[model samples]
Target: MTDLNTLLQSPIRWMSQATDPDMRHFLRDLQANILKGHGRHFTGNIFVSFEGMGAQAVARLLRDLSGYVTSALQQLCTARSSAGPGFDGGPVRCLLLGAGAYRALGNLATMPGDAAFQAGMRARQVALADPPAEEWGEGAWRPGNPAPDAMILLANSSFEAVTRDLEAAEGWLNGSGARVLGVERGRAQFRTFRPGGPAEGVEHFGYVDGRSQPLFLAEDLKREAAAYAEEPAPAGADTGFDPAFPPSQFILADPNARTELGAGSYFVFRKLEQRVRAFKRREEALAEALGLTGTKAARAGAMAVGRFEDGTPVVLSDNATEAAPPNNFSYANDPEGMRCPFQAHIRKTNPRGESTPKLPPEAPAERSHIMARRGIPFGDGVRDFEADAGQEPEGEVGLLFMAYMASIEGQFEFTQQVWANNPRFLRGLAPGEVPTGIDPVIGQGGDEAARTQLWPAGEGKPMVPFSFADFVRMQGGEYFFAPSRSFLREVGL
Candidate 1:
């Protein structure tokens, strides 16, 4: 027995030691230094909480946590680091806070000073004043807990500096009564894809991924009662608090939070091997069997997934050209799935409206899940290998798939179990069927239909609309939680 209870309490214990108003200043200096990082190999992430700590306290910790993070990052930039010839691809960017960082505000009752308490209480006001969209790329923001003490971010760093910073942070946090949590060297997978080639890495059937992320202020987020009541409820929800633990699908970190919620993000890294030859052979063979030619069959295949192979959405611009504005299109323009089959890979993964198990906007059942995709393609290193060649099982080559989410069961797991890995997703079809469970880019599930997502979607159609012979493969992975900066300062040494 691993004594899961004790394991769970470890991080909390480390955090209890660093509880002081002065510790806040130490964190501020740390933060300032981190914000100034310009290293190439070194990446940074931040998490600042007010949980057991307070606003003046959090303000204290936030001011310097960045410094330690930056120093840790610099230590990771050495020449011996991964990113070597065979290094796996994960997020290279360090995530910072949005409004979600407020979760660290801690238990309102446990904090001190009535005046400071009031300011700390106003985090929601601060949150409403600013949101993640205002910070991350376009509408992109960081989210999720993927490992403790932000260990995963040190994937390719030197141990000496990591040790130095580790000791310093440990010293401060140990003084508090808080505990530190860690999942050192947690591994993630990355899957990559080649145009008209084999599937490998993440996001196999290529439809602009990381787009189906949860909309915090969407009409649904506001309709719920519990969602609004728990902790830092989203803007639409009335939780008074803000969602900070998982931060966003993008990376965001905090200073002293143990259960930082949405305050920080993780760098997911996975190696997805694509079967290039397999996909091409399957596509070409399917095209010929259907008595279709270049453009016609290609169009139909594109229709199966809401987008073209070049990362363009077909629903908005059914054309196969890369010029499609898939990233900025409105769902109102085309919601019926006429151009893109309702079972397309992209559609299945992010079913904006076509969900079969419909629930009210306020329903708590299906709202917990929703993640941001921050993955990239990694394979064939240079040459765009033939998709058909990849199918032959020559080994290697594919997208390095990586995703970040607040709750694995809610976001990543749901996407895997109900959408990408489940065939009957849209309505009622074989598991892993096209459109519903089709994972075109870097496949991870093992069900038969998932192996050939196109099979079922094409079965009943009178004209046999689309077919996918290719398969996406999952290499390996695990789950983790990234803690808040305060948690780290108190316990992660």
Candidate 2:
């Protein structure tokens, strides 16, 4: 038997011909969008409910759909010829089964032992600080709302392609003993600041997204190392950030699979609506309150976001630069939250090296909480940094936040509850320090004081006080398990 942990420690080179059978089988059986994101420009999520369907009938439908599901190996092969770092396969499909689906299938006992997944997202509302289910958007998770049993993800390079694929899928699903509840569509937006440079991914809020990510494959690590080595290091640049992560961070055993190599990942999906106009207006107000004006006023938003709209980390540089942003740094150098405020969005969620008891960057306890984020912007809104005063979007625009993790309680929930929404996080780093405050961008359900941030002034000066308003609202979400290809194929048997 292959020691899965040992095999995963060494990154699997998918393209290598001499790769071991164990690694190759694992990749072939694992579903796509876990090890790497399905970076297609267009995506559609089809929520399905099998409330009235017979178990046998639903099983048949799933068994048939399994054949069309894409695997990690297949995605990599299709994207090998692409010039960029995304999958090129048109109309790629990934099917995720919710805990309710397992119950409907009469296999709830065999589902992965995750309490949060079993309890469902709506049941944990108070823990996550999410609004009541009734307040969420239409088709959101709520009791007596015909909970979603399955979600079919369709992705392609164009909106037309994704639409056509979704239509076809819905047509077949309608007659396959399943009912389609609702559909969520997403598209990738990019901004090209330079005339000829490649466009970088940006959210509706005009900030670059998906820059810092954990690398699982050996080839990806090598590629990143080569790129970092080729780029000349800036003055005082901390290149100590290690992006490598073991497969154990995401992969978990499939309890009901037919083979030992079969594995899957826990998936978390949330619809976050961004209040762009309010957030931008608040940024300007904050700048004015701090007595900053002109070009220096941009620091207000940068401090709140932990990075400028151009992707430059505010901790590293006070001003956004035209050059490519660097992610190879930690908070070890700036222990006093002087460079990047403790309440900054990125810093609050990912402390990098900062911790309550001051853990190192490579500590297993801290690193275990990291998950693979694969989110993309959903609504049509502003995608530029310098939009006019009235140009920012106020509603129906934000992130279709999606991520994969080994444990929902340990990773996604821990980051959201223990870090982002907590005001006293990182308090033990210094003595007699005030509450660090909740994350300004995504923190929710906090009091006015909890939402207040302590903005640093110059050295030896008292910190300025600024309270942030809620700018991001959670519309709806669910927990799912992306089963291994082998398990999906064999589940209905």
Candidate 3:
């Protein structure tokens, strides 16, 4: 196994743009240089559970697992070394332990700092903070299920690489410490509505997914600024960012941290099953009701998703062909939600300027309530939503939703509960305006009848209403902590 402490303490000669241009020029003159790895696309996921395992056995498992940790530095080097067209940066792996697993070790008393990990993923506090019962489907989530003991994440440039890693992991874990209770493999699929239409890469809904993500930075000052930037600036514009901060939010400091545990991140794992057929039929029905047809019928879907199937934000331009950066648009200009309905999936989750009015005047700059989402699709690639609209789904398929954060309650949970699931979110509406509905895509409606969503046709048009059947069903999930390299070693030792 890799020496966790030594790995953590090793000098990482990372290079980047210098804060002082003069100092950078001096370094260039002296032939000094530095480089760092950008992030990698781990397109595969495998979640494992170790149940009924003893403390000693769990420790041994972690020791073995340490051998699989892939550092960011390695990723950079791999990318640099690639020479051929098919050459790749190789796979990266991560190991995370769930709250139940930690409690089973009987070490919460020794490591009181891991209170959040001990709380488990489905704890009442976590559930309440992330979408209440009224927002979830009937008995879909929060069914008093036991959480997983651990999760194994493997990311590679290709599916074959991931499969090979999965096989190796299964070999490594065979009776190593904990017996495997379950294994969920995550894979990515691509398809387009037309030949060469809207890059083949799309979620089951036929819209480009995972387009908007928070920036990842390493500095405290940058993170502080980003946390404030989640809400719009005073002039109702993006708080123009300083070049100092990386355009990412992964830099948030984790509170109640134990240094010995190394730099760790909290993870929220969910197995979501998408009802593609149901969603398509509903969209078609809604489009027909709204008198939307042909290319314009696409608007009905865009109103719900806040973007067309081609990833163009309707708030920015009506034509999906007008390719633009999807994340560049904000909600400030469309306060009345004429361009983007307040209930649109993108609008509800990250309201941007819309969040400012909801903040208490005395509160700290409203933190963006950000989470670094890293999830991939799972199940067989099914694109029958268009052809098999009225029929039952051919097979199971959907997103294996996963997110990394410093605080489950603050980031991931808040986005889900306070934003996505909140019907009354994006405050400061006129007295007579109706309250915004739940996110049409992922928002759970307690009962079938309550699943209504609002879809605006265009400016000066009445908000069109469409009821949704639970299209995305939550199967199971858990909360886990991915400890730093050193922390894993300490636990094993």
Candidate 4:
């Protein structure tokens, strides 16, 4: 068996040695897009369902599909050298199988024992506060509709590459007995800081995103630390924010795979539609309500988002114009939600070591819940920040939120139900204060009274109430397991 601890500590060095046959086998069996994100500019997600297919037929399908599945070792090798295969030297290809797919292959008994995965995402509709089946668009999770048996995730450096690969996969599936249920495409979007300057990653709401991710590999942790050291440090910034995590946080043993070293991760896929115009309008209206004018008016949105559009954390610096926003800050200094409000989208999603008071400064409880999010925006047109009232897309454009976790219920679902959707969260931290309120960005069902606290007058002043609205709506989603490459290759036999 591979020394998982040692391997995770220094993946590059471990792979360089290439002496440990067990470690090599482990990585070769494990699928890609779990340990590290693909970081591709364009992505194509193809959901396939098998109808009335027998175990023999499903096994045959898996055997054929295995040819396209990229292993973790392949991805790491490509990352190390640009002369590898696929477009732009590397195109990520992954296969995720749902509960129904496992059952169709007659392997349900030995699949990962996740109750949530077994029950499917549709079963958790009430708990997640997701819209009913009817509200979900076609090809999404709905009652009576065949649940997606398998999903083929293809990503590459360019839109043309992704489209070409997607078409090839679809053409093959047409005769493979599996039916292509739905297809979703994602492309990276960026916002230009200056007219001629390079663009930075931003979601539909114009907020810098994908920061504060948990680093699983030692090399990544070291790289992040080095990058942080090179940046200009702001005074009072907490340098103790450690992003390193153990390999067990994301990987689990594949019960039915051919190799003992086989490993996989639980994948959560959700299509979220952003009402950009409404959200932007609300931000401006909230600024007016808080009596904030001049440059400070931007804080209205920052109060709800926990960061300004430039990715500057409200806790670290109130000035959104501050260059190179640092992601190294924690909530240790602003425990009372005086700076970054407890209900802020970032705060709600990742508490950053402030969820529980009794837990030590490390806050392992909060950190344990962090998952590897590999999402991409799936829409067109640059957001018109100065557009008219009716302009900007209210729907048909949003995020293809994808994440990998060891436990669906513990990490992804817990963060949503217990933190984001729960208005009572962080209430224990501040006794006798107003409800922390739902996360304004992604919080689902809540009453009109659900409002976030904002202190425009600074600390010691009463908070202004900004009623929360559903700016991001759930279009559809499902849960699947990114199976081990060994499992996919040997399942038929």
Which numbered prediction scores highest in TM-score against the true structure?
2
TM-score of candidate 3 on Cα atoms, chains taken together? 0.77
- Residue-level lDDT of model 4, residues 1-493, one tens digit each, is 5654455443333364378687788778888878778878889999999887889888888888898898888887778777455636468899999998888877533667999999898889999999986788766355556778888999999888988999999999988888888899998877775555557888888888788887776667778989888766555655446777777778777777787677889999999989888898898898888777899888889988999988888887776754667777777777678778888899899876666665567544777788999999988644554443357777788999999988999898998998889887766445666677788898888776554544445756677776856899898888999888877888867
| TM-scores, each model vs. reference | 0.49, 0.94, 0.77, 0.92
Q: How well does candidate 1 score on lDDT at residue 492?
A: 20
Looking at model 2, which ten-residue stretch has the lowest summed lDDT? 231-240
RMSD of every prediction:
16.1, 2.5, 7.8, 3.0
Question: Which structure among the candidates has the greatest lDDT?
Answer: 2
All models: lDDT?
0.38, 0.82, 0.59, 0.80
Give the alpha carbon lDDT tens digit for every residue of 247-345 in model 3: 223322222223422345677777778877778777888888778888788777788888888777777666575433334456656667777677788
| Descending-lDDT candidate ranking | 2, 4, 3, 1
Q: What is the lDDT of residue 73 in candidate 3?
A: 43
Error of 4 at 354 (Å): 0.7
List ranges where model 4 is wrong by over 4 Å. 3-14, 83-87, 107-109, 140-144, 194-198, 232-234, 237-239, 358-364, 381-390, 428-431, 451-456
Q: Give the TM-score of candidate 2.
A: 0.94
Instruction: Tell me how candidate 1 scores on lDDT.
Output: 0.38
